[model samples]
Target chain A: MSADVLSAYPASQLAIREVGLRDGLQMTARWPSTPKKLEWVDREAAAGVRYFEVGSFLPADKVPRFADVREVIAGVSRHPGAHGIALALNQRGATDALATGVQEITLVISASEAHNAANVRRTQEQSLAEIANVVRLRDEAGSATIINAGIAMAFGCSLSGAVPEDAVLRMIDRCLEAGVDMVGVADTVGYAGPRQVASLCRRIADRLGPLPYVLHLHDTRGTGIANAAAALDAGCRILDASLAGLGGCPFAPGATGNVVIEDLVFLAETMGFSTGIDLGKLVALRDIPAGEMPGEALFGALAKAGPPRAMSWQAARP
Target chain B: MSADVLSAYPASQLAIREVGLRDGLQMTARWPSTPKKLEWVDREAAAGVRYFEVGSFLPADKVPRFADVREVIAGVSRHPGAHGIALALNQRGATDALATGVQEITLVISASEAHNAANVRRTQEQSLAEIANVVRLRDEAGSATIINAGIAMAFGCSLSGAVPEDAVLRMIDRCLEAGVDMVGVADTVGYAGPRQVASLCRRIADRLGPLPYVLHLHDTRGTGIANAAAALDAGCRILDASLAGLGGCPFAPGATGNVVIEDLVFLAETMGFSTGIDLGKLVALRDIPAGEMPGEALFGALAKAGPPRAMSWQAARP
Candidate 1:
């Protein structure tokens, strides 16, 4: 078979970014100690996972789970070729994140005005301005760190209802103008279906030719993995998912975690797109969170069912 | 907007078959009483669900839960325009099912030889021969009932693994030659990914133009809903799903239920297809099963998260 016939999306371009330590632990009942967190990063990196959202830079008093963000990033940096990403809501958080010399710092701006005001106590314009300041700080420091501005509630919002497509595009235009290295569209509350995800991803590609963007999805309504496949169909190569399907949005009622990374890898690999991560090793990593959290329900089907026996179908591709 | 712009697939062409009564109750920890089963049928029918797999015609000793299959069908038959379907594994089950005057009767034959042998204790050829015998019996009875031969493990088999596309097509061809009114391809073990679904649906369409086919998918590995979307994209309009995702296969280890009907309806309605089923009413019906079968886990996301505030996007389209 020809290379194109082997897979719709080229394997080299596809990437799965693990956000378990950061997004997965954000709303957990218990937190893994710094050592356990480092162990997760190390083991996943050894399993061929190249990108990880280690933690977020936020107030220690508010989200004490991520209080050891600096230590986590330092440990992640020790592994060569493993990129660590952290989240920042404001310039202060962004400055602190920069001080850690993290590989990537994500700044979020909700597309919905109500969500923007409620989440960060600022208007959409205000959030955009903060992102600009964060970009300036990175440039002035002569750092080569990548800045990714995520448009939260880009698909729809729990507070504001349906987010218009043009509003999300406008936010992306502003983020691009702010000199961010990349932009991401997030279904913060899992409001997006596959059609909506495909429509939005196609529009993003159309609006900004070859500029890179990521899809950060939540599985609150069971559409996350489908949306991920739609993104791949629309030529999106980077996706954000959590281990054991951890994480939820406080603002979005009944919200669940991001799409499970293990299942996401399975979906990608089985679809003939190589994710570089070993499915067996990555699925085994679920035990870490299950052991640490104890009572917390870690969700994923691949972990429960194990990999299909015929997983080598992709390997036999000529 | 033109009607074509409203939905990629015309709303009238889409159909969701409720398999909860037969598929859902099969493996439940507790089975609802006959009256409760009738209530489920009545409520979902009132909610505008037209097609239902009421129960299977099996030996009462083997599956006592379905011993009242006759009563359930009698109850469902009273609802005008509500079509009841029943399953038959052999000629005797088919004879009993035809006697009930059910609107549709489904006969299953696994594509994988091992799965067919293990599931029905017959070879694939033996099962196909029985299907032909059932069709002869239906014709001789001069019944208007539709015979649907479901190719179980059509995508892949847990017992044998990786059922090839040609194998499924061969089974489908034989079924057509046997004079079945309709055919279905099932992902019995949840091994199918979206790409495989799209490819297979396309081939089925190409091989037999305009032949109606249903996709009976399980959410064993979290790809059920995604596979449903791919089927729709590939022009297969019929889908089989259960309420609260309440079915599993003994042969497929760790198997969950069929894709939740509530989520499937949510996905269809949000994608601009008019299912003619009330989302709220259908979600509310989940309570009946929960109350009747206490401690049996009912799975679905739309029931937990509720519909999005801006669900009228489809209605507003041109």
Candidate 2:
């Protein structure tokens, strides 16, 4: 009997977009100090992760969690060379981002019609209009802030059960029409299984062709890391992660736990992927305790279980 | 780039064991109702999961959290054709298990010297002796309880840093010497990443010659589900999981979260394995609210994020 030999995925590389400072803290009640976040940026950069979604320029009242957007951006930008990213929900946020001197900007839109309305109090069409306006504003500013139109709720919406591929496709088209530099797909509610993640990501990548893509995944369903792994196999490079897996959807029922950055980094590194991360240092980072974070529970396996033999995925290879 | 092709993993005909009633509650401060545990068993069975680690059989005073083991066993066994697995730490536990008339009997041994000492307060040799006695007891009882000697801490140990693969292989020899039916591997402290899990499992499976090998995983470090999936790819069939991602290492620092049974089932299904599960029913089972049991944070995605359209993985193939 011929042994059914399965090929290991190609040696891949991933850029972790640390979103804890933005999306993660935004969903929580107790936010961290901007200095602490900036400190993490310095340290994470040292650990070798690039692309960081450092903060979001949303109305401070809407999310006091990100009250230090300007401070964070200013602090991270000082790092000689670091890809500090900020989230801009509208033209105003984009304009605010243009001043902070960040290298990248992410504009988000909800794909689920119901989630778009309930979450941002706007329709998908309106969110698209805002994205289009943000794209134009970014170009006019002549700043190098690469805008990646991040589509939230692309797989399944918290409010709606079915997220149509056609609907998600339309949003991608809108982002491209809006002249955005790149695009991102998110399983915002952590509703997507791997099959859905692969099919949709493959479809989006097929449409966009080559240009790098980002995946913002939630582990609310406990499939975050697995889905992220699947996304990598589907040709996604940039991964949006929260330190200690600190992320969730306020609207998505039971949506908690972003793909754990430390754990995902370990998975990639061990699998012979050049994640440019030090697994040992990443594990130590998750060791820090964040208290009274409420429903925002910290999630991951490699941290608690300890590394399988103080084994750095790199040490075993090189 | 040969248009990187996306190969879908068939809806995994995966078998999940919800250990919340057993593994999760056993190590924690609280254990919910016989009714609640039974309710979960019935709900999970209807959800298409065929096996469950009903509960442990330690003295009630020693593990009052699992005093209802008999009831759980009786309640779950009534489900016509379901696999009810029970954990037996000693001869007494095994006696109770034999009396309960379970389909399987699983014993534990930590591959790490320090871990084995801490867990059952015995040396590796002592544990083996106990395991051998339990195996003999099962034989005498004329019970069909398949003996599974799970060697935990196979990858690495929290206290013992690096658990050598040879040590794990030796434990398999001990289990085999005991006349046990099958032997399984576990990342007791969640120290395993995908590569470590795959490598260790492959090496162990190579030595064991396939005795219905199982993987008992914890998501403490966050790679539990991925590790389990990797084990499956490495040729392990029997896997251990807990409903709602419950369970943790009482001794290990900051290690909690099991491989969520529902999420694993979802991964298997979406990846194209026939787990013989009903996703819709599984999602609906969330209303049972396993989280109300106190201090245990239960998790599963399909229960929260509605299944993706293409998530009817089984149906998609035909």
Q: For each prediction, how big is the interface RMSD?
A: 3.1, 4.9
Pairs of residues clashing in candidate 1:
none
lDDT of 2 by residue, A1-318 (tens): 111111101124457778887777775657666666767777777777666777778788977767788888777777665667788877888899888767777877788777778777888788778877776776777666677788887877656666778778888888878777777888876777666776777887888676667788988767788777667767777788888878666656445567888878876765657777776776665533253354456666666666554554124211
- Could you say which candidate leads in lDDT? 1
What does the lDDT read for residue A36 in candidate 2? 67
lDDT of 1 by residue, A102-198 (tens): 8888998988889889888999888888988998998888876788888998888878677778878988999988778778999988888888889
Native-referenced TM-scores of chain A, all candidate models: 0.93, 0.88
Docking class of 1: acceptable
Overall local distance difference test of candidate 1: 0.83
| Candidate 1 C-alpha RMSD relative to the actual structure | 5.2
| A-chain TM-score, model 1 | 0.93
> lDDT tens string, model 2, B151-171?
887776766676667777788
